[model samples]
Target: MPQARLLPAYLVQRYHGWKATTYQDNKSWYRRLAASGQHPRAMVISCCDSRVHVTSIFGADEGEFFIHRNVANLVPPYTPDGQTHGTSAAVEYAVTSLGVAHIVVLGHSNCGGVKGCLDMCSGEAPELLETSSFVGRWMDILRPGYERVKDVDAAFRARALEKQSVLVSIDNLMTFPFVAKAVEEESLTLHGLWTDVGEGGLEQFDPVRGEFLPV
Candidate 1:
């Protein structure tokens, strides 16, 4: 048998230590969780930024949230083209299979993906202009947001786009028939969140006011 190319030695050691301590303190909890399947109450679609920790922000425990991470936390409109859609797949599973009550699209400040979109739209990053650029294509989901905020000052456009991305995703989530049906029946609720990493501030979207309020 061939050995797998594992993570760095220090990270592996840290994982071992964490595994031992977690199991030692929560052995029964882990055992019970293994016996019973996970029943998370919410599904969180969050940015794939290292600084953003969804679980830490909400003080969520294991099996509490079904999390899906993607660039800029953007959700493209639901298209049933039979092509691969990782984010859509996760959303479908969370709604249909897990029956989660809440779905949150979490966007954060200083998202590299958002910045990339900004750069691409502004013609600063020509490399992203290529049709073969995955980041460019994926970030295209946020292009509509950029158009809305294009007139804003360059310094603030990025931040504006970050919040816009959340709004865009929330709209896209509704494009899915199952999601719309669930929402219409009051079986599922959608939420949008924007976080400031440096200032440790959290803002929640208010559908009534059409704005994000501090949390």
Candidate 2:
């Protein structure tokens, strides 16, 4: 078997520096965490976009948040087929094994995945229509969301779909039986949040108001 290639030198140097500083600053915390185990109270489902920093936004510490990131931060409807379901597997681990009390679907402004879905639904991005387009199939999870926001003016469709993605993921989360049971027993709670990347503003979804409001 062949060994994996090494990372770039710059990244390796940066990682070493960070490791040194982290050990100097919080050696005991790291040691304790290693001896004990993770007991995160929340699971954050977020986008794969590099701009969205989940821990920085929430000021979370190590072992505090169990995060699962995918394109558009989507949670597909529960399917028990014997296929690889990465997001579903993460949700199962968070809910059943970790017993996370809260699940937060974090969406964001100017999401490329949402834009891709918008483009695909609008018949603008023809390449994504191919059966081999993994991203296209993943973005299909947000197709229903695109339908709900498609009628909006082109200028605002991307933002609208972004928020809709959060709502859609929340709805899908409930489709999982364990998640539904946890909610019914008051053992688990769900939240929807969207962030404006440029303005650095946060908005939370209100089921009662059926809108995202500033947080």
Candidate 3:
């Protein structure tokens, strides 16, 4: 195994600063959480993009949300093949163990993953179609979403596909038996959200209108 390097000085300094302030002020709360364990009310599946701050967006505190970040924030259709599936594992734990009441699939504008998917679908990015490309394989989850927006005007297709990624994830979530059972019993709900990273605009998917409305 390769030797692990020490953390950078800036990160170490920041950690010490946080420990002296935020950790000191919330010591008791942290201890209580450690003892009582987490009981988050929602599970947020959001993009791996640093700009998409799920906690900051909702002003959520520690232990309040079970977050799972992935490339493009995707949830694949249920494939119980006993393979290593990180996203599916997180969902299973959140629904069956944590009993989260809501699952939010968050997407955003100006997303590189969405752009990559659009390029791959349009034959502009052939490298992503390689069998050895992990990103390309993972992005297969959004191919259906791409098909839905392929006919959209080129100027709006990227944005449209970004929202469709959220919708696709929501649809895929229902394929999980436990998730479907919880929703059927009214114990859980699903939501899709799209944000404009540059404009700080937020919109939510409305099933009734089949479109995203400003939130």
User: Which ten residues in a row are the worst by lDDT in model 2?
Assistant: 1-10
Candidate 2 structure lDDT: 0.95
TM-score, predicted candidate 2 vs. hidden true structure: 0.97
Q: What residue pairs are clashing in model 2?
A: none
Model 2: per-residue lDDT, tens digit, 47-125? 9999999999989999999999999999999999999999999999999999999999999999999989999999999
Q: Write the residue-wise lDDT of candidate 3 on 1-215 in tens digits.
A: 47888899999999999999999999999999999999999999999999999888899999999999999999999999989999999999999999999999999988899899999999999999999989999999999999999999999999999998999999999999999999999999999999888888899999999999999
Model 1 accuracy (lDDT, Cα): 0.95
Order of models, best lDDT first: 3, 2, 1
Candidates 1 and 3 compared by lDDT, better number: 3
User: Could you tell me the lDDT of residue 162 within candidate 3?
Assistant: 96
Assess each prediction's global lDDT (C-alpha) against the native: 0.95, 0.95, 0.95
Q: Which order, best to worst by TM-score?
A: 3, 2, 1
List ranges where model 1 is wrong by over 4 Å. Answer: 1-4
Provide the lDDT at 18 for model 1. 86
TM-score of every candidate relative to the true structure: 0.96, 0.97, 0.98
Top TM-score model? 3
How many backbone clashes does every candidate have? 0, 0, 0
